[model samples]
Target chain A: MTTTASAPGRPAPVKPGRPLRIRRRMTPRRAGSIALKTLVIGFLLAITVLPLIWLLLGSLKTQTEWLNSPSWALPENFLNFENYQVAWVDGDIGRYILNSALATFPSLALIVVLGVAAGFALEVLVWKGRGGVLLLFLAGIMVPGQMILLPLFSAYFQTHLTGTIWPLILTYTATGLPLTVFMMATYFRAVPREIFEAAAIDGASIYRSFLSIAFPMVRNAVFTVALVQFFFIWNDLLIALTFTSVGDFQTIQVGLLNFTGQFGQVQYGPTFAAICINVVGILVLYLFLNQRVMRGLTAGSVKG
Target chain B: MNNVFGNKRAVLVFVGPALLIYTVIMLVPVLWSLGYTLFTGSVITGFEFSGFDNFAKLFSDPKVGEALLFTLKYAVILTVGQVLVGYALSLLYVFWLRKASSLVRTLVFFPIVLPTVAVSLLFQKMFEVAPQNGIVNEFINFFGLPSVDWFGSPDTAFLVLVIMDIWRSMGFYAVLLYAGLLDIPEEVMESARLDGAGGWTLIRRIVIPMSLPVLLSSIIFSINGTLKVFDSVLALTNGGPGSSTTPLTLLMFRTAFSYGDYGYGSTIALLLTVICLLVTVFIFRSSRRDLTKG
Candidate 1:
């Protein structure tokens, strides 16, 4: 095993069954190692994050500058706020944002409310045939949304729910439900029996115990489910693309695709600006809820 | 306490909303699509009970064959690329990246949140032609290689889709596998290390085996997800340069929506669903076999 005292840029070799504990004293070799790791990971991070940064910078460039200059070249005017204005006005991005929010928030709220309720029931309440019902929802996890797209579209058309935000909302809620319920169930089930039993002795109803005790016990799961559902609905293009016919009802993703499909080459500035804002909005949200999102995504693999 | 906790009405109240929504929105649609396949019609012409006619047509459709082959190829490419890159990055995280891994993981996973259209647009900008050649092409030209039209050909367009899909998703796999790796008890790792296990030997014998379930889960996940891929490819290429990159989902969407061939599209959708289900079951069975044997 290589020791940090001897080898620069090598991670401290562990013995076994122990977390990688950071060394306190920095020898010259350790310092160099730290610097090198920093540089390498910094480079990797740069590769990952810089494209979006470049896209933001590119958004600021005039159409000619964007087409003419090296992608890295600083824009002629740093304060090209007009490009964002154009993206908002000409590209119809604000409406797309509004549509995305309309589609996403309702779905997110429904996913949480329903997910928490179902999770509590399956985990806390003694219900008959819970396993069978759970296996049913588990099967939903295997379903590809494409399989349902046509029939759902037909059903929506039959019911006259097409071309509106409601179809989008309903589908998002439905598709998001299985995983939300699954993830929430896992989290709620992990809460100790003693906690619930204590609440029950106070004569709390299952619903009341869930709200007062189990919900707080699984706040992280709530965050995880909400954040994951947010990304799913926020980034969904297929539902909006296929189900919604009204242009005004299209989500930001569909709107961007349509914008890029038509004006991508000729109107480069506003397109990049639109992409920039879309990326920035999601990136900001991700940053704020980073841990919960990661937990949600990785929740499946970690849980049985 | 037991009385309050397990009251039948309370149970109903707790689980009713999600079960209802899930049934109507999710589960019903699966059965509905299966039902739709039995009838044939256009949105305009109205449906008639056609009785496996759509499936009959699907059997003879060369386009169906092409789309299936393309989807299989696409799924294989994405699943391999995503998992391999993810595994490599996971190794990097545990072995070398260490503290810097957090930021790298964060940076990598950031793409998972972006709108698929946004990612496709950015990458499209990166690969588009001159006078505003994408920076990638520009970099290639910087090395003085002749300009290559990436999306101009079937092969390159497919390659571009694969690469773009990998970029958008590889981070997700890395984080996923990394979490799995961290779950391996350090004693197993250290003992493996102490017993002269290093490099490939350590990862192969210890890390990978310990992480097999997660590995299997990810493979199943990426493959099925890739099989059903639509939004990214739709945004990136729209199955174009002449349907070269069209997956089943895109084909299904176009057939049903664009051509208004509701029956045929439903048929393709059913095929894709079956493919996903088959792949999932096969992987689960194989992983179980591995568990028992290895």
Candidate 2:
């Protein structure tokens, strides 16, 4: 809601024609500031956009053309979809994408469900050893992911869960819990205590209050945490690679690695194509969940 | 009708599933890793419990020693660089460059959202040696500097990994810091200026102290992330050039997957966990007000 107001107190309606008058009376200092801003903005745009252009260009050109063509220039053709087809088929990125979705989706759902409960427990529910419980969750966040890899591998080995996505799915869910709980708890804390108190007076139990009142109020935050967890799980490569065999349950990131073998011959064209696909998928997801994450972060931090 | 259940039990019921899964998968694994540090190799070989033998071996292993040292060096450098560079970029975005922050945020955060494997591939092409059409080497040759054997030489490869990682992550830290900066009231800055505080004085005293929590959190984040680095290293160097840039995680990976020494790998992993715990405890102790008390 602070989006509209630059300052607190009286909200002034924007004066019509003021910007035009301001520009008409602009001093040299203002013009110089504007010019410098434009230059910097352009520089940032190039840095962001150029690599993508290079990736697209490389994807379009054949190996010979890619080596010979100037890196700055675009490819000659726009209709080239050969690389996409090749990446889809030869790279088998299509299957990997499916596997990634299957793994990430369940993990995302579990994070939201469990995270909401955890957030509720810490912030609202009265329990013995509350600080100890919260500390246990925080400890999960502090543990370096590397330290768990071997132990997880050994544990999974004993359980005969090797070469399966279940271990990865479970790990992602657990690893994601601390962050999701943090964000959700921060959000739920901001809801007026009176709302919960009123519900309690009405004989609504804590679970009832949470389910009927708190959860609905923080839907925006839940969406944000879900998006963040989705992105993390989707982009995760380490646990995916470590837990699964090369071809059995490979995700997109691990599948992408198969393009560059030990012989140093790289399938740059399809590899770039696969990267583009994955990036586009992420970008689309982000765009879809844009407002939730951005606003969620702001709300959570400002309160703290 | 609902009086049959109390609040405490309801809370436990609601929280139980998540706590169960997390403890079983995450907490148990940690304890199991710690346990692995005790047994000598495996049970199949009629293993005997050798108390702290693994921990002793860990201290004595030169490779482990080297990896830990290199990881510490890189983590220190990366944390400092990330905070400084990311803070500067955030300041630039918030104050000097408003419109560009919008554009640059997207650009910088773009890499962070991408899979790490793809980032490694992109960097590999950029850092490919000179006279071979790599982007970075092409620029080096253009400047008439001798092309660095990045990714080829032990001396320079670690630097390449560091640079690429920074490029990929600078935006994430920048975004976090930018958000922190944006939270400060403009009136505070104006008042500081009116009070005749110099630019550095205003930033160092007011802006920085206000954002200390975010800054500290960013440092902790960068340290943790750098310590567990695997995907980028695996894809880029695979701990090559005689293990010059092999971090602790990469070393642990080689121990388990490459060598099938699960017991030893778990030992390395446990030691790393202990180090991380110590560092995290230290950070928490120093910044408890910001992280926990707040």
Candidate 3:
């Protein structure tokens, strides 16, 4: 692990003294590195975390206080659960949460099932002219999802799928399958081809090779692809807003926005509180699943 | 076509359901929407075949023109800012702040999972007027300057929307670039340094050139994402202050769903799809040049 200690235009390496590469230069380059690092990291932190912090602080403040105070400053009070209570019962996020779960969980489940089955078949199943099918799969990636909005809406209208969660789930599964299949197919392709050959020579059926051998080898990719698609379907708002306008089927994105106006008041505090909960919940889940998802993303990129 | 030889039958079997569903749900609508370019129609009443009237009408329509211009403006701002900022941040994480990279990466990518509507709502409240305390306005007032209407005005509305988008996507691009940076073999950087190539020379001459594939892909992703920009615009301004923030998707939605001008709306959708596909192909081709050079 060779490290670049210095670049051009900078010289006079300092005596190694204070421990841990602390021997430093006070030149503009050193200062710029420190300043640049500080500014970039601070800007990212402020942009990413501050909104949630502001949301939390706003949740604790009264409507008057929140509206009147500067956004970044904290509320004067502490641990006020009143906003949470109002947000849960009054704003109807309780029901919205259920709606979101209903829409997201099924889509996620379907995406995993379809993605894995397709990935396995593409990888392990012996087939001539599978290249064309793979090209069709890649074409899905090239298509921008919004292009389908009109026809999807029209399709739903004719199929009686409108105003129900089914349409959103179905659209989500379709849109999600492309990238999932793309990522997982390449991933499964990376599994040693000889292993599948050996399994076949042992009189193992194609289904058995996929079920008993290839599946376990690529389980990490499968899990990561599933979780990433889960987040995609979960964070979606356009499809939800477009396909289902019945309000009960609104996912959290549409749900949270509509809640701001629901109870005959602005209710900024509770909306902020609910947002705080949503932020923390998703962050925690992503953190737990981050490693697997990131590996899948990088794996896909390298293959590309 | 013996069963054993053509057992690719099962391959089709496995991939068929997903491809069929995706084609029906996602691809078919795009094709259907493209058909709208040939007709003048309402959503409820069937459309008559007018053949290119919708496209011609699109040129004459001021709102569609404005929305297209705005979408381009937004894409330019977002791609430039996100790429530059993301590259800088990736440099910081890779070369400067390796120890904090994991925590920073997780925190930054956290926003990628956030619902756009929620982000828009956060910004909306933060920029709301009449309170004198909207963070942006407050900052303006604290500087002893008159507070400008941020989203309430056309120029500022587009600017703020662009900023929100940059904030959302910069981290994403940064993480991707960082991964590319990691893929750069350590010996190359050391050798570059041994040759006294540092700072701008090292980055411009080496690091960036090496990461061109990732960079181009990020650019393509940003362009596609910006061209389809909707949820935040919908949640933030709803193309308000007189359609200043309206992008293609919003315009398409309005035409198709809001105004019941299905023909015109589908024309816009087809136009956007073609534009996006062209851009994607262009980026992919350019990146191929970079990859071969590698």
Best by DockQ: 1
- Superior by lDDT: candidate 1 or candidate 2: 1
| Candidate achieving higher TM-score, 1 or 2 | 1
TM-score of candidate 1 relative to the true fold: 0.92
Q: After superposition, how far is residue A218 of candidate 2 from its true place, in Å?
A: 1.1
**Candidates in order, interface RMSD in Å:** 1.9, 3.4, 2.9
* lDDT values for all models: 0.83, 0.76, 0.78
lDDT of residue A155 for candidate 3: 75
**The 10-residue segment with the lowest total lDDT in model 1 chain B:** B129-138
Per-candidate total of colliding backbone pairs:
4, 0, 0
DockQ of 2: 0.47
- On residues B1-294, what C-alpha lDDT tens digit does candidate 3 reach at each position? 224224766777787888788778776776787887788767567779998888788889888888889888888888889888888878978877998778788678667677788788888877767554567777778889987778778888877887787788777777888988988988888789889998889988989888876777778777777778888899888898888888888888888877777888878887788888887788788777867886
Q: Write the per-residue lDDT of candidate 1 for residues B200-282, one digit (tens) a residue.
A: 99988888788988888889888878898988888888898998888899999888878887877878899998898898889
Window of ten residues with lowest summed lDDT in model 2 chain A: A295-304
The fraction of correct interface contacts reproduced by each prediction comes to 0.77, 0.54, 0.64
Model 3 spans > 4 angstroms off: A1-43, A67-73, A263-265, A296-304, B1-6, B285-294
Candidate 1: C-alpha lDDT: 0.83
> lDDT of candidate 3?
0.78
Cα-based lDDT at residue B264, candidate 3? 83
Quote the positional error of residue A288 for candidate 1 in Å.
2.4
For TM-score, candidate 1 versus 3, the one ahead is 1
